[model samples]
Target: MQWFLLGVALLISGYFIYGKIIERIFGTRPERQTPAFTNNDGVDYVPMSTRKVYLVQLLNIAGLGPIFGPILGALYGPTALLWIVFGSIFAGAVHDYFSGMLSVRAGGASVPTVVGRELGTAAKHFMNSFAVLLLLLVGVVFTLGPAKLLGNLSGTSVPVWVAVIFGYYLIATLVPIDKIIGRLYPLFGALLVFMSVGLLIGLAVSDKSFYAAGITLENLHPQDLPLWPLLFITIACGALSGFHATQSPLMARCMENESNGRFVFYGAMIGEGVIALIWATLGMSFYDSPEALNATLAQGGPAAVVNDVATSLLGGIGGILAILGVVVLPITSGDTSFRAARLILSDFLKFDQKPITKRLMIALPLFAVGFAISLMDFNVIWRYFGWANQMTAVIMLWAAAAWLKRHGKFHWVCTVPATFMTGVVNAYLFSAEIGFGLPLSVAGPIGLASSSVMLVWLLMRGRREQDDLDTPAIAAEQA
Candidate 1:
């Protein structure tokens, strides 16, 4: 019954957040042709039908972040899933949809471009540089973390070094933004569906105890930290992700119908939120002890737990299928990451315009960096990735708020979610001070610093615009 409720919530949230709100705002732009300013020959400039756009966006945006965010959220309990689902629909979807539409309408520019236009050239470059660094961190954490986990699940005995090398090569060969994603994305989607269905069936047949693994209301932790900050961490996907803002604009360029932004942006986000909910639920069901969870995560790794859960539910065949699904999960995510890295480099550095050899030269080094990170400690990397992801979302939320105010519809929209997230993120950073609570690691501080800078910039920009409006107009009578 809870699962059914979750499914319904997922659908409703997707419609409201993405379908209604996003479509209403940017949907009108589809009828218009690509703006003259954005004339580029790369995949970043290619136009496609709304359906295909949605599919690609869905796969690309729904990366490993969703998979792990919920697992961490589940540490708080099953109810954490509630926050993730709701936040994804109401907050995450809205930010993604509008950010994409805004970028498209503005000549297929990225978030950094939007920032530059609204703020200043200096701000644009600053944000772009920050985004590049953030993406590199994300590539390392998100791509490599999953690769290591998948390796554990497969038992292929491919050492971390080999797995990382193979993964990088596979991505370079199969997921190049220019030629591969269009051909391979659908195949990846098919693999995901097969694995998801197989795992679901296995769980259903062998595990009659649905809620046994869940943390009940009575088990809620009695920490002194405020609810809002914890919620910020638990429902981290939508409110403010650095990663989403980067990818959203990239997807915007390919949108067939500008009006479809809501569906593609919001719908895809809801899909990711649903993915997170499933994984978190599974984690809770399979591991009851925090120590045990950590130990298992340490020894067998998180991917191993995914296999254990599937095996517990489905026996030997199910375990094998589950392993296959786990393996594909990271690969799909890595493919998306690979594409995102390409887009970041191509757009910011104009690398896409370079000769193929030069482009390859740029891509190879990035692949190597990611591979090296994968061979190291993925858990530490994931923590920083989460922080960077949320920080990006924070900037987008502020931008969305500005957009709403500019359009004169601020009163009707649910800006509270955005506001709440901003405050919570700030508080999370503050908690680290005075040494009274949990300190988010170095990566957390980096994410917090970036978000703080962006927020201050946005606020000042808003005030300046308002001040200009307040000034009286010069009269022609003096002439």
Candidate 2:
């Protein structure tokens, strides 16, 4: 319980303290016109209040990752709390803030273009392909998962639910930003908040049975998965996700002021960390023991836990609301994942989005591909999505580090986390049976050594390219 409370407090306090530090480090320029105004095409770049942008950005990046991710991470123990709190403030929020602000300064450039500008075109091209694939994979998985749930609720067939959901994605992807996303997101955001807050209240007042499973130094994960890299990767979106970097550019094109980047980007990430912490605490403390929770998980899955909590703790009207929250969170994220993919591709092709025909030209083929993937076994897609999500973050973090270095700001703010995640991704890819068949002992050292080498290389490059602190670093690295 103490760990849970402290984690909650840390996430809230982080927004006020660390958020401002990041804002200053990025040197926000309110006097400068943001892309929302300068590039207000009304298709993807339309100015909006900081609050709306914050909410949409929140739903865009979060999906089921923060909610389910933390619950799954909790299976590892309270050490997951450490990753959620520290990683959110130090790594996640900071990454989002810088990446969003970088896009704003670049006239709403997509993340790949930002990477190209800061890191190099080769890095940019790699990210372009990697990000689009990740987005499509996430979009399809989120779509299929939610549609299946909605099917259960509505008594509709899975294929029918899928077609309906894909119809929405098609429209949402093709329409202007304000048409569907800007209007409905506030309601979805409110439902999300209400569900989380209700569970929090339940946790506070419920029997000690709920809080009995508080974590200790001992490993409690049923599978005995090593905590080092697995825990970090498990809790990506709420902590440090590259997926957030992709969504940042969406809000970057909609921000009203450069100074608003802190609130929209950094603040939204901290908000997600709080949601993740809530789910983690509930997942951990609700069970009588780690073994019990694992037993339940084995029988069902993460959604089973959501069903248990919604029906058991928050009964009555709150229960209905809780169930709906679980149902819609993925839908909200899926729509925007497709939307973000469209924007990324548009930027990549240098295609104007002013024509609805042009938007569909790209969106149709993309959706066709995603729809085909939806036909395969979803678990396979989800397993790869998790790894790809973190790998994307690693690339964006390196881009942020390069941006900071050229501008003479504190590059370590991003570089350190980037290096850390570099190790995390490599370790997972090398050690996990789902990935490579290497032993953890061997893969762990190799991952860290590789990351250390890259860190040193980045530091050396930064030293060579030092520039005046008074001006922003806008130079593109050589291809």
Candidate 3:
């Protein structure tokens, strides 16, 4: 309990302190016009207030990642708390702030365009496909999961619910930003907040021993999985998810001023970190031990555990409402995932989205691909998402580091975390069954080598760019 409280405090403090530092480093200019106003299309680039954009951005990235990821991460014990606190403060928030702000500066471009501007054309092309694929995966996964849940609740079939949800996604994808998403998101945001806060109060009032033991760095996984890279990968969203980079630009297009970038982007990530912290604490404290939680997870998955906890902690009606909040998470993210895919494809093809026909030209093909993938086994597709998600973050962070270096700001703020996650994702790729399936002894060093190469290249490039900037000044002084 002490650890959880301290973690929450640290996350809030991070927003005020570390958040401001990054905001200053990015040099947000309130006087400048934002893309939302300059490039207002009434569709994706519609202007919105800071408060509305903050909630929209929060829901855009929250998804099931924070809730499910941390519940799984709790298998590693209290060490999960440390990662949630530090990772969000330093890495995740920084990644989000820059991703959104860079997009805002680039006239509401997608993540690929932002990366291309800083990292070069090759990166832009790779990210264009990579980000679109991830968003589609998110859309499909979120779709099936929610459809299945609604099926169970309503006594309908999964296929029926799926068609209904996909239909909603199509409309949300095609419509103006202010029409559906902008209006409904605040209510969704309210439900999410109520659920988390209600659970916290429930924990306080319950007689159950919520804290199994004092905070420990020891591995508590019943399966005895190694903590190094596995814990980090399992707890991506709360810590430092790459997926947020793809989602940040969605809100970036709606921002009214450059100054709102920190509050809407960085602060929203911090808000997500809080949600992750609550879920992790619940996973740890609700069960008798790590073994018990593992058994529960194995038996019914994250949603089952969420149901048991909410029902036990809150009463019947409250618990049902809380569970509804959880359902809202994936659905909200799914619609935006498709929405973002449409925007990314439009940016890539240089197609105008003002016409509904043009929006359908990109969106129809995406849903066709998403619906096809939805028919296959979901677990196989999700296995790649965690790794791919972190991989995207690594790219975005390096791009941000490059942008900072070019502007003579503090690049280390991004470079350090970028190098760390680069190693983490690579390490997961090599060690996990999805990739090489190598032992950690070999994979760990390989990951280190990969990150080291990136860090060295970044430093050398920063030096060259700095020298280029200095050359004109030197010639003037000499004259």
Candidate 4:
């Protein structure tokens, strides 16, 4: 059942990502450009071919967000995989594809720029500031936590601080998107594929017996947590995430083929969702007791879980392979985050295009802040990221709906995605209140606040359209 579901996810992701969504949204010929910004340069503003842009966007958005997020979701068992697989295809992919195309139509503007035009400059600044804060939180907690887990698994003498510093340095050196996609991405992808295959092989060979000791679904409930909130957390990546909006715009700035936006943005999202499904299955297949899994994770961290699973299947080498996989996954995400931070800073600060060195200046501080945060409490930062991510998605979905209405195609293209996003977000908000028992956490409040703002904006905008229609009819009759 798990493998079948995973295959379904991969197929859907492949189709949408390959071209289906883009063809529907863009329809070949280019749209009109706003008179606000006209200058274009080859270096930062060069037009790219669809294939190159698709690959670059894939790498950019396919980072650690999907991997770590899914692993966390897997704690709930196999049902989580079901949500991720379906949600990625319907909700997450749609959000990313539309957000990227909308930005492209607006002359390669980032999310903040698009929001600023529609919701006022103050809203744009708020959104950017919120995005920066979310990124910083992600860098410190989720991004760096994966590295620390890797260090523990590898049994390397390297201290956590040293590992983190080296990680940041590696990211700083690869700030240029071209160098990252051209050189580092392939290497990272190869390592991930190798490790994943090895782990699977080891699992097949393990003598412990799959259903005997490793695969029992006993004692699945550890905290007596309700099913719904657990499901929300489990199915997190497929629903709304603020991080995706931020990521979509970064890819939008360099899109080669406006028509390939669906493949790059939606495809990458589905890829992440598929990865999550695999990890969730692993969680179910490997551990019998949720308490044991939690205890193992707490004692040895996530790497310990991977190592134990690998060792059970492939022996000692499994531990080594697990460490390698964990370490490389974070590097991929860190590189993506570093580039994202640089782009966000450049766009927000209006830095000079010359002397690309200036962009590094901005990135340096952001990296330092991320590094410092990583050294502190990581769990808090991660929870905050979850909330902030959902908030960003809510705002973007509302915007996409509005854009679709303006184009007279809201019924077919925009309505469904927007409705799914709004429903999931609202579900999560309620989950936070009744399920997680965190009535006042930032995640719940931000989601509520954003949803309220979006509802008002959609309603008022609709009313204004009606008023305009009535005015035109009145004028015609009088004439």
Candidate 5:
């Protein structure tokens, strides 16, 4: 209970303090024209209300990551609470703010274009493929999880739900942003907030005591997954995620004012942090101890926990809330992931999305690939997705750090966290992760060597244009 209170306080205070610091560092230009105004193509670059934009952006990034990831990450102990508060404030929100601001400055460019501008051509080419793969993986993961739950909820076959979800993903990925995503996101956002806030209230009224005893630094994970790196990767979106950076530019193209960047990007991440901490608290408190949560997870997977919590906490409305949390949220994220994939590919190919044919030209092939991956075992894909997700973030953070340095602002805000994430992602890859099955002693050295090489490359190559302040090239680089 004590830790839960502190987590909520920290997440809220971060918006006023750290969120402000990032805004000052990025230096948003209120007077300048945003891409939606300058490049209003209607199909992609449509101007939108700030509230609508915030809701869409929040739902886009909010997905199952914060909820599902936190429940699993709670197995690591109370430390997950610390990561939710500090990592979101320092690392995750910072990454999202800079990426969104960078896209706004670059006239609503995709993340690859933004990376190319800051990190160079090699990184751009690398990110072009890497970002697409990440989106497809997320799109598929979100699809499988939610479709299964919705099938259970609606008493339909899993394939029926898959077909329904795929149909929606096709439309959401291809249609104009204002139609489906723009209008429905506010409703979805309300439901999401209600679910989270309801749970918090339930925590207070319920008989279950969130045992602060077994969830401290001394009581490590039952699985013995070392906290050094596993905890960071386990709770990627709740704490930090590179996936948020990719999704931010979608909202950047619609933002009316640069000053709202913190509200949309940084603010959304903190919102997610709050949600993550709530679920983490529930996971810790609702169980006999953290170990019971782990045992339940191993026995029945994430859906088990979500079903148990939602039903137990909110007795009457639990069924509806369960469907919303386990089903609707992922479907929202899944569709948007496909949308981001389409936009990234369109940006790379120099294709115009103003034409419906052009939109289908990209959407058809992307979903085909997603369909192929969806056939794989869901959890297997998820494990790989987690590592790959953070790896992408490490690159984006470095790119954002370079963006700050070139603009004559403080780069350490991003660079320091980027370096820490650098170690985290690499360490996870080196350890007995995915299929490596290597010992920690051997993995540590391998992780360090890989991270050191990437850091050196970023410092040398990421700043060629950063220091070249004489050429005002921001306008010329729009995607």
Candidate 6:
């Protein structure tokens, strides 16, 4: 309990302290016109109030992530709380801030475009394909999830719900941002807040004690999995996520000022971290032990745990509403996933999105592919998403580091986390069933070596560029 309160306190304080430092390093220029003004297409580039944008950004990057991911991460005990707090403050929020702000600076370019500009053309092309596929996957996965839930709730078939959701996705994708998403998301955001806060209140009043006293740093996994990379990957969205990088650009196009980047981007990630912390605390407290939590998770999955916890804590009607809030999570993010995909394709094709026909030209194929993927067994494909998601974070972080270096601001804030995640992703890739399937001894060293190589290359290259920029100034001073 103390740990939970301390975690919440740190997350809020970090937003004010560390978040401001990041905002300063980015040097947001309020006087400079933003994409909302410069590229006012009324489709994606419409101006929105700061509060609305913050809520929209929060909903965009957060789906079932902060809830589901942290529930899983809680198997690691109180240490999960630490990761959610520190990771969000130091790494996740920073990653989100730069991803969004860089897009705003680039006239609201997509994540791939921002990455390509800083990381080079090769990266741009790779990320273009990677981000589109990831977004399509997000669209399909979120569609299937909500459809299944709605199907069970309404006694409708999964296919019917899928078609219904896909249709909504199309409408949401095609309409102007201010029309559907901007109007409805604040309500969704309210439900999300209510769910989290309600659960916190429930825990406070509960007869049973939830927090385990003096939880240790020791590995608490039932399967005895190493705590290093797996925990990090499991807690991606709540701590750090590459998926947020893709979503941030959607709001970047709608933002009216650069100064709002701190609140909208970094603040959103912190909000998500708090959500993650609540769930993690609940997961640890609600169950008897990590083993009991593991047993329940295996039998009914995270959704079952969510249903049980919410109902048990809040009672019938309140619990149902809380569950509805959970339902809203994926739906809000799913629409934006397709919308982000549409924007990414439009940017890659150099097509104007102002025209409805042009929007369809790009959007139709994306939905087609998403629909097709939805039909097949996607569990195997979904298994790979965790790794792909984190890898995207690594790329975006490096791009942010590069941007900082280019601008001569403090780059380590981005570079340190970028390099650390580089190792994490690499280690996961090597050890997981999806990748090389090597022993941890082999995989850990490989990950370390890979990150070391990247760090050396970035440092050497940055120094050369700095020297090149300085040479002319030095010569002019001498003359």
RMSD per prediction, one decimal?
Answer: 6.7, 2.6, 4.7, 6.9, 2.3, 4.7
lDDT of 1 by residue, 313-397 (tens): 7677767665555555555445555555665566666654335665566667777776677666666666556555666666666
The TM-scores, one per candidate, come to 0.80, 0.94, 0.95, 0.79, 0.95, 0.94
Clashes of 4: 3
lDDT score for candidate 5 against the true structure: 0.83
- Misplaced by over 4 Å in model 3 are 463-479
Quickly count the clashes in candidate 5.
0
* Model 6 C-alpha lDDT per residue in residues 1-479, reported as the tens digit of each score: 67789888999999999999999988878987887887787889899999999999988888877887898888887888888999999999999999999888777888987888678889999999999888888888788777766675567998999999899999999999999999999888888878888988998898655445665787788899888889998898899999999999999888888889999999999998988998999999899888999988897677778888888999988888788887888888899999999988887777888999999999898899999989876455555777888999999999998888877788899999999999999999999998999998999999999999888877865522442122233223223
- Give the Cα error of residue 298 in candidate 6, in Å: 1.3
Clashing pairs in 5: none
Clashes per candidate, residues 3 or more apart or on different chains: 12, 2, 0, 3, 0, 0
Candidate number with greatest lDDT:
3
Per-residue alpha-carbon lDDT of candidate 3 for residues 1-479, written as tens digits (9 for 90 to 100): 66778899999999999999999888878987877877788888889998999998888898888988999999988899889999999999999999988877777778887888778889999999999999988898889777766675568998999999999999999999899999999999889988998999998887655444777888888899999789888898888988899898888878888878889999999999999999999999899888889888888777778889988999888988788888888898999999999988887777889999999999999999999999988777777788888899999999999988887788999999999988888888999998999999999999999999999999888433543122233223223
Per-residue accuracy of model 4 over 297-324 as CA lDDT, tens digit each: 7776555666666566656765666556
Q: Please, what is the whole-model Cα lDDT of each candidate in the order they appear?
A: 0.59, 0.83, 0.87, 0.58, 0.83, 0.86
Q: Cα deviation of 412 in candidate 1 (Å)? A: 7.1
Model 6 lDDT, residue 180, Cα: 93
Q: Check candidate 2 and list the clashing pairs.
A: 210-285, 242-393
TM-score of model 4 vs. true structure: 0.79
Give candidate 6's total backbone clashes: 0
